[model samples]
Target: MDQTTLTRPEAETTTAAKPVILTGDRTTGPLHIGHYAGSLKNRLALQDTHTQFLLLADTQALTDNAHDIGKVRRNVLEVACDYLAVGIDPAKTTICLQSHLPALAELSMLYLNFVTVARLERNPTIKDEIRARGFGRDIPAGFLCYPAAQAADITAFKATVVPVGEDQAPLIEQCNEIARRVNAAAGREVLPEAQALIPEAGRLPGIDGRAKMSKSGGNAIPLSASEDEISRAVRAMFTDPEHLRVEQPGRVEGNVVFAYLDAFDAAKEDVAELKDHYRRGGLGDTVLKRRLEDILQALLAPIRARRAEVASDPAQVHRIISEGTQAAREVTEATKREVMDALGLFRL
Candidate 1:
């Protein structure tokens, strides 16, 4: 037998495999340009290269919306529509509702025992969130324990790659800690390790130039926004303050219109020219904003049309989510079984 040419009975695993990627959006409302620059757009492209799972974090949403579940329920489809509108192909990406997966809830419960109240309190992500929500003094227990829930979302799918921004970096660290502690306690590496895939996303600002663009902040351009709406939002966008006059030298340094261009504008020369034109004076804020308007429309037109087409049959959009959730749970349940057995969670 020629060693080089020999073909054994058992074939070697030579096929290329894409690692699991878990990323999600809370069902607060429809995703927007921030979601595009921050996550959704990347998910659509990543689906081509990796096995991606896009979660509708309804369960996580409830951590804060426990008192107002109606908002969460209503926005579940809104979030799904946002995903579909952003070109997250359901065929290429798994779009799942988090609440539909019992394994996540079970895994969260088990992981909860591993994390301490002090540890949860020390979670920078949770702490900052608590402060932001004015829950510092009256924090809900569920809201505080969400890192455990997030860890469940991650490990339930055995996702190895999580796309996160800088602010959420601590959450990933917390997930890794859970994996480490659980593995040590169980004496087995049942849960897969996860890491962040920080893409070169120029952090997009809100219409008001607030540091972050968030739906809750009410400064977002929803992915499903109409062309007219997009135009209105863009026209209302904040630009250089000192650039009061058309001939005034605009400070492109902090101008959000230019920042949007920097994030969404694909043409390097065009963006550079626009930046120089604004910075050197003689360019009106209206002119720069209109340029951004046209540029944004070019990108969002197709998405808006597609969103309209899908919005007509919201039921179909939701069915896709339900189907993906079921398929995802088939895998999540298998992982949960292994995790449960590792933790000695037996039914006797």
Candidate 2:
């Protein structure tokens, strides 16, 4: 066992060192407000205190984007920019590209022995992904095996804390199971179990009132969306479908505009009053949409400006990724050696 990796979460002790947090995004597209509300904001707040590692999961992205490798490659930088634009300081957070660490692949191969095809199929996260992709019976082997791969990512950094949304809690649970199994097999604890730290109100509904906001859904507002783009998205947002006229009382429940307002609008009393007006009638959808647009514009303006500033210098962004990747590679290499030694692999 690595005594250093076995540190417990401090109990009633302010002087204890901050917990290490590992979280990140897949580089399939630019992140959206859903990402911000879910984990990105937590990253910004935790980066200054915790040992944070953020992964641009291009290799995981390949589980789905094998045919369109270009799209995943193109958005890696865009995702990094979004991270910086939203106040994830490179100086504080180590942002690494997943494919840059061959050790992760090696670790995944070793971790696979601890997991099973039946267990991977039962993973709610993978099941959801399979359904969302409409794969039915044609699921790719890589896609099916990704949970083990993800376990490798978590264990490689010896990450004790994984910040994720509720939907991904199962992934953390799976990692814990793998950790316990591997340690038992080796007759000692080599890997530490990771705990899931879910943020408050982590999941946000899409503009279309869908269950999730994602690039494939075409209902997400990019964190770097322009004012015009934001306005258009807000205008097109889903509202009470039964309320056809301004005089018709609307339903606040499940309205996308109200959901966004509740998440981002700081004027809680005003929003509550608006909800009252909306439900009582005489409030137009246009008025509600316009209010959301104004709030969104105010919220996104600085992020957009920062993204533009960062995007203007592509080389600097690459350097940050390159440097972080190198740092992460060193860490994973050490982890790989530990695993290899425990499994009795030849030193040569």
lDDT of 1 by residue, 292-334 (tens): 8888888888888877776788767767787787778887898
Report the lDDT tens digits of candidate 2 across residue range 89-142: 776678889999999999999988999899999999899989989999999899
Error of 2 at 228 (Å): 0.3
**Candidate 1 stretches greater than 4 Å from native:** 1-17
Error of 2 at 50 (Å): 0.5
Cα-based TM-score, every candidate? 0.90, 0.92
Off by over 4 Å in 2: 1-18
Q: Output the worst ten-in-a-row residue range by lDDT, candidate 2.
A: 5-14
Model 2 TM-score relative to the real fold: 0.92
Candidate 1: 10-residue stretch with minimal lDDT: 5-14
